[model samples]
Target: MPGSLEPLDLGVQIPYHFRCPISLELMRDPVTVSTGQTYDRPSIESWVATGNTTCPVTRAPLSDFTLIPNHTLRRLIQDWCVANRSFGVERIPTPKQPADPTHIRHLLTQSASNSNPYPTRLSALRRLRGLARDLDKNRSTISSQNSREILVQLVFADTGSESSELTHEALALLVLFPLPESDCAAVASNPDRVAYLAQLVQHSSMEVRVNSAALIENVLAGSRTAELRAEISNVDEIHQGVVSILRNPIAYPRALKIGIKALFALCLVKQTRNKAVSAGAPETLINTLADFEKCDSERALATIELLCRVPDGCTAFAAHALTVPLLVKTILKISDRATEYAAGALLSLCSASEKSQNDAVAAGVLTQLLLLVQSDCTDRAKRKAQLLLKLLRDSWPEDSVGNSDDFVCSELVVPF
Candidate 1:
């Protein structure tokens, strides 16, 4: 609510009427509520947003939440700023009014109409996206009017014969706000809708593709029924698309993270894990995990652990040239969860082959394991580290390995 105008000289006092009572700053966009009190639009909007039911100044109960723009007061403030230009008070640019609920309703209606031309519907959708991005009030209005359902319906209405632009725009709006679980369930429960989204993950438009990948993740995370989850997990296109996103160099980090989450969700089914392995998910994840700053290391590692539960996942990881070094580097660098997953993946590789064990040792896994065993990571991670130390020690001559102190405890090490 503090005005964005430049500060005025101490000698030049701002008129009391020109200031918002709540912020005590000059009013850039003065608005009067039903209680007859004028305040900055942002300040009063913030107050009402916090569930305040009364006027700040008069303390009167507010039955109406209407904020009437005070044009006269705004004009007066502009004139005052103009008169005091020498005092460093710059004229405030006119502020755009927040979208009215009625206008939002009209746009929603227009955007959802199949009778309207595609161009017309796209225009309405663009405006709605602008409103949702611009202000909290606009989003609330749209959300209250069942925008989620309308957008889902619009996307489902697509028959592949229509322009893809409309479907993409609808998807963009659907992801702009976080849809609750119930809304996600609505999309996930419908086979046609889920199939449409899976297909969209590979769309030519990068924006549309990434949005679809993220929406799939949301649907997976929000699926309440096991049947719905199993249905989504079985989509072969989704698995391939997620792997493609992880491998795509042009894709942004957020998109890659979405793809990773989607992969994690899909691989939850034991049978689907092999499908991901066959789709080269481990190689894509290894590449992603190689760059720590660019992508989510913990999730990428967690998904790797999940993938390694099967023999094919371990074989894929063991064959990768960068697997050992990547896992060795990631240990104890990120969160405790990341350390656990990294250790878990390395252990999976070791359990799979003797060559992988030699690779881990050559890549300096012993030092990392020693440090990991001594450090304050999770108990689960430390137990894995201790088991690794024992495995390495037991595999080779005792004298060739490091001190026995690294073996702080003994625990069974299982492959992820």
Candidate 2:
């Protein structure tokens, strides 16, 4: 038998001869023995089930080594297990500190002093950055209303005489802060706040414009108010600013990218549909389709993609100057893969028009599509051809059977 255990005079005493082999710390999962020998919980459990008759360390003869855990130790084990299982990992605890008004004031002051003022000292900048990171991580800690207010204040801070850098930072901060629906409601409720964002959409710097576009997207995602949607729709100066960028060949691609993103944002609002319709957004889109003919193949394809997204009702205008034949000829002329993709888009527009659809069928659009379908080309083009054929079959007149040679292909007939 092992000698009686000695009592050590240590300030802090831990139970068990061996630390928990699993955790490599204190004996968390504890088990008691018949001879009152205690072992790490997991070790004892394993031994009890295996019908071991003696202690591994003491080697004492054991008649009945009942494994019972200490209540306190069991609770700790349960809690640790739950936390591990629930979170799937342990999280490092962050120290709690009182809110520092001075830090907030300093950030605001710096923002006011420079158009793009960041912390001067490396330590301070790191700390500020850390705080921003913490705020992002613990966003649920603050109420939605408070978070939006703080974000709005940050957005409004004036950075000294340099407007560009400061504006960029402010916009960056706006994008970084994740606000809830309630917060968006609070920020958008205020006309002045919405107006401030509208102004940023027209800011001189492209960086600012890009950031503003992102902010608008975030705001519109949660917006429900018709009045707010109408206000945004009516911002002609901002729209013109965006349009001017799109019209400039040198800068248009970048600007059009932003404009398309912003338009997507506005489309999220149910009320903005009428506003877009009223603003002749359809006409603008049609114009883009026409402009595609003059642009590079890649750019033309992008323009076609954007044009397809124009509201469905806008196809009524296609019968006038934007005839189906013109679009088909344009598509047929280009040999690039992208131009082939644009041809698919043009087909969609042709289908959209009541008059154009009839004209397209008569003018051998189906024959051309069948040839493209059978050609050794991209899967995207082939898939588009399949879709066009399906749409044409569904739309074909009852008496229009056996009129076209292209429709008589073996593969097409099998499917039909």
Instruction: Give the number of the best model, judged by lDDT.
Output: 1
The residue pairs in collision within model 2 are 29-41, 113-160, 114-159, 114-160, 115-159, 115-166, 116-166
Write one digit per residue (lDDT tens) for candidate 1, span 292-370: 4433778889889888879999899888999888888889887789999989988888878899888888888888887
TM-score of each: 0.81, 0.44
Cα lDDT tens digits, model 2, 264-314, are 456445544544444444455545544433334345454444445465433
Worst 10 residues of 1 by lDDT: 407-416
lDDT per model, in order? 0.81, 0.53
Which sections of candidate 2 miss by over 4 Å? 1-149, 157-165, 176-179, 224-231, 234-245, 248-254, 268-271, 277-280, 283-355, 358-364, 367-400, 403-416
State the displacement of the C-alpha of residue 317, model 2, in Å, after optimal TM-score superposition.
5.6
User: Candidate 1 — which pairs collide?
Assistant: none
